[model samples]
Target: MKTLTVPDETPVFPLRWVVATNDEAAPLVIRLMLALVLFPHGAQKLFGWFGGYGFDGTMQYFTETVNLPYLLALSIILIEFLSPFLLVAGLFTRVVGVLISLLFTGIILTAHVAIGFFMNWNGSQPGEGYEYHLLIVAMAVSLLISGGGKLSLDSKLAK
Candidate 1:
């Protein structure tokens, strides 16, 4: 029987680079704010908290009403529901940011664009607008650029 030898060279995973963060307070504030704001929304979708539809209802709306594919609808629900905790821990900040940005962008294009830029604060419009989504996108983009800062897991991981 012939023995196979392993190569001496091994690939390096850039985990540090991915999780790298600075000690700035700005990112920490932004990250916390984003997470806090999103957590309730997530809770609504996942657990029916805060007047949300919960998983089955949300899935139904996304699939039947929105005409989204099952996998994509599931992904949106999971991301919204789970990402807040990850964001709070400051884990995979950039990746989360990208996911949020893409999710909101999709929402804007699919649901909110026709309603225009302002939210339905007065209930004057038939639906809400894209302004809130735009703000979320802006926050996500900031995290993508800055990472989780200060006392974040990403900061510790970087060091």
Candidate 2:
């Protein structure tokens, strides 16, 4: 009688394939980096940190310069500050991400588009302005799709 040898196979997680087809780390990385980058701007708008225009200043810009109503100005401010805080904490991230993504679109179209593509800190020069906002928009879009990761408050709250 001849003995036959059998090869051992490892079981694969089919559910992982269904839920996360690829490495799940990229979305989380984007979330962390974007949160770090964007939150300070929100803080500046809401609280005047990091050389940002605070509420009064932002309201002035929104109303006088941007020609938006006070309600819209308030809405934008609330979304900017509160959403990023939730995003950084990884809480209700999908909702926040979607809202902020919309907010960035409005800003880019209204304010940053005409500035062109060079970061001109001075208002005198047209800038590489929309580029940064575009990147933020991309990041928010990513988060909206991916949701918060295992490292997020959403995950914790879900459990």
Best by TM-score: 1
**Candidate 1 vs. true structure, TM-score:** 0.89
lDDT of 1 at 141: 94
Backbone clash pairs for candidate 2 read 117-128, 118-127, 118-128, 119-128
* lDDT winner: 1
Task: Residues 1-159, candidate 1: write the lDDT tens digits.
Answer: 433333755443356567878899998888888989999988888889999999999999999998999999999988887888888899989889999999999999989999999999999999999999999999999999999988889877665
lDDT of 2 by residue, 68-155 (tens): 9999999888887777567666776677777878988988887778877656777677545777888888888887777777567666
lDDT of each: 0.88, 0.73
**How far off is model 2, as Cα RMSD?**
10.3
